[model samples]
Target: MEKLRIVFMGTPDFAVGILDTIYQNNYEIVGVITAPDKPAGRGQKVSTSAVKEYAVSKNLHLLQPTNLKSEDFLAELKSLNANLHVVVAFRMLPEVVWKMPKLGTFNLHASLLPEYRGAAPINWAIINGETKTGVTTFFIDDKIDTGAMIMSKELFIGDEESAGELHDRLMHLGSDAVVETLQLIETGKASTTIQAENDEIKTAYKLNKENCKIDWSQSGKMIFDQIRGLSPYPAAWTFIKDGENEWNVKIYAASFEAKEHDELVGKISTTKKEIFIATKDGILKIVSLQFPGKKRMLAHELLNGISFSENTIAL
Candidate 1:
């Protein structure tokens, strides 16, 4: 096998894991392309991507191009003399960039091809209540995620798993998948498959704040899944009107109980032990929550402070 010179492009914690794997496997990472540092947080400090930080740590040559198609950036990339390029969790590439590498550019996507073939794949699969999802490595083309597939690996979505939980699992799993794909490419034993367009296809569009709000009209299980899908970040929230004061409550950990409810739907019921909110089908017991203008806390602790009486309806 010829010694392969590779250029890596990615920009998140998920991408960082795969970058580390390639480094450890003795793959010659000639250069790393990551997103430019931008202002973040209250302090407005310049924040570098996780990939950039990792690249600096390993003393690898790094590039942060604001525009991939710019002549200077393309020239710099060509200087690396890379035969192959790897992309993960990065923006769509231009033809000039993807076509520059002789061995062709390949992307390690988080979902199985022809399904969940968009951004936020892991989040959408769990949000839609799918039983399984996986990762894929494919050649890069002009169309987004529509290319000849190199290989794919499927994994079961564990019961009661949240998006964040599944994300961590796929990150490590994806690293091995990329390494395996590269091994096949090196041995010239890799084959390609055309993607199928069927009605069973799923997409992972980006999650918005409006969609994260909990809807009480849904069944307890559906509401629970929504909450779990968005938990820990961009959380599932509900509003409670306390007289004229509206309180935003972000619900994190919850469980569904199909118990006899004496109150109307969307009503708040509370005991010293738990705080249950009535849904269309059953009550959702909120084990963890955060009141407006306050940090996250246990339901028991929140119940002690806030007065969630009979008329306190969660929006």
Candidate 2:
């Protein structure tokens, strides 16, 4: 069979793996569509998307368009004469672009379709204490993540795994699934299932400061899951209050122990080497944290530099 003329679209590190897999397998990637470079970081230097960097190294035909529907960009995309367009961690495409290709466009979503179908699937899944989550490849439609599914792969979530860890695993799993889906399309064996509508569907909306705050009024396990789910990026945060001095702190790691206690929720218990906070059901032991203007460190190391009195509370 003739190699499929694929146009790959993506931006982040997660998308790079799938692009590499397709290229390494000798698939014909006619073009790559990625986000334009933007100024970033303390130095304000221009930064390229991970997909752009990989495309550059491989000498692939690349297009970085700020406006997806602009006539000039649309013409350039049309000139490629791609058979199919594969979107991973990329922005939403206008119909003029996604529907231009002969075989149509498809997206590789981080979570199983009809559930957790939003921007931050991996993080929200862990935050909601889901024990299993998976990736799905679905045909692109007018709505977001509400498309016909071509394929899916499931995986178990480790009991203590953080969001960052689960992200890496899904990145590779998504790469393999993309390859398999493409192969099926090449052989004219591809099939799709329409996603069913359900009111009980869980949505993975974007996370923000309001949602990332730790709520001490919740159970120890619930709070622990929240901390782990957002760890290492947009982490779960709380205010540490000592007398009149209050500072915002991001908690990166913690463990929970269900012990019946009369301590008020949000109360803090501290020692020379450990710090525990009372929650609705039990106590949560902070393992690592980052204070404002400070790097992340172990709880013991942070304890050495700061002292918490019995009256201390995490507000």
Candidate 3:
């Protein structure tokens, strides 16, 4: 068997776990490629990607490519002379790059192949109210997430799980799956199944402010799903008004009751200790939220500081 020399590619904290798993297993990581350092957060401070930090901490050869197709970047990638490439949470690869490795490149996607095949799989799966989502390791092709599957493993989605929670679980599961795939490839025992075309697949559309905005007219369950799906990042939001003052609020946690309610849609009902919003068919209780210029807090804690009148409505 030919010894495997790997080049790993990814950004974000999610990829760090998988890359660590491979390194711990003693893979010959020839080079690491990640997005360049860029400004982030309220301070606009330059930040290095999670992958870069891990690579540097372990003294791995690293490349920060601004353009995947640039001659310099390509030459650097080629110089690594790696047989395999493993990508997780990385940007799309040009043909020249994905096809460069002798053992070919593979990607670890957060969702099962042929479903939720896009950028925001974790968020979309919870938003769509899926009971199950999983991880897949597949040979990278020219198209996005449409690749020959080497292995897949299933995980049950908890009814109360947020995208952040699910993301952590999938990251660990993916680490295991990727390690298994690497072993199969190294031993020449891998058998890949080509992904089939399916129009009914639910896509993980890129998240944006437009989609993150909360709509009170939706059913309590739907609005609830939206909240958890977007929680911890790009949180679901709404405009809350107390007849006199309106505040755009970011909702991080909530529960829902599907019973019919006479309260006007978007109405915010508050007891001394809790807050609930009327939806199309029921009520959504606000658990954790943030007000503009304020940190996130429980609804009751927020109410202690800022009261909501009976006329208050979540717009």
**Candidate 2 accuracy as lDDT:** 0.92
Clashing residue pairs found in predicted model 1 = none
Model 1 over residues 1-315: C-alpha lDDT tens digits? 656889999999999999999999999999999999999998999999999999999999999999999999999999999999999999999999999988899999999888988878887787778889889999999998989999999899976788888888899889999999889888778899998888878887888878788878887878888877776777788997756767888988888877676767778878886887888778888889898778899988987887755677887
- lDDT digits (tens) for residues 51-108 of candidate 2: 9999999999999999998999988888899989999988888888889887889999
Model 1 misplaced stretches (Cα beyond 4 Å): 259-262
* Per-model TM against the reference: 0.95, 0.97, 0.98
Backbone clashes per model, in order? Answer: 0, 0, 0
TM-score: model 2 vs. ground truth: 0.97
Cα lDDT of all candidates, in order?
0.88, 0.92, 0.93
Q: Candidate 1: worst 10 consecutive residues by lDDT?
A: 303-312
Ranking by TM-score: 3, 2, 1
**Every model: Cα RMSD to truth:** 1.5, 1.1, 1.0
**Candidate number with greatest lDDT:** 3
Worst 10 residues of 3 by lDDT: 214-223
Ranking by lDDT: 3, 2, 1
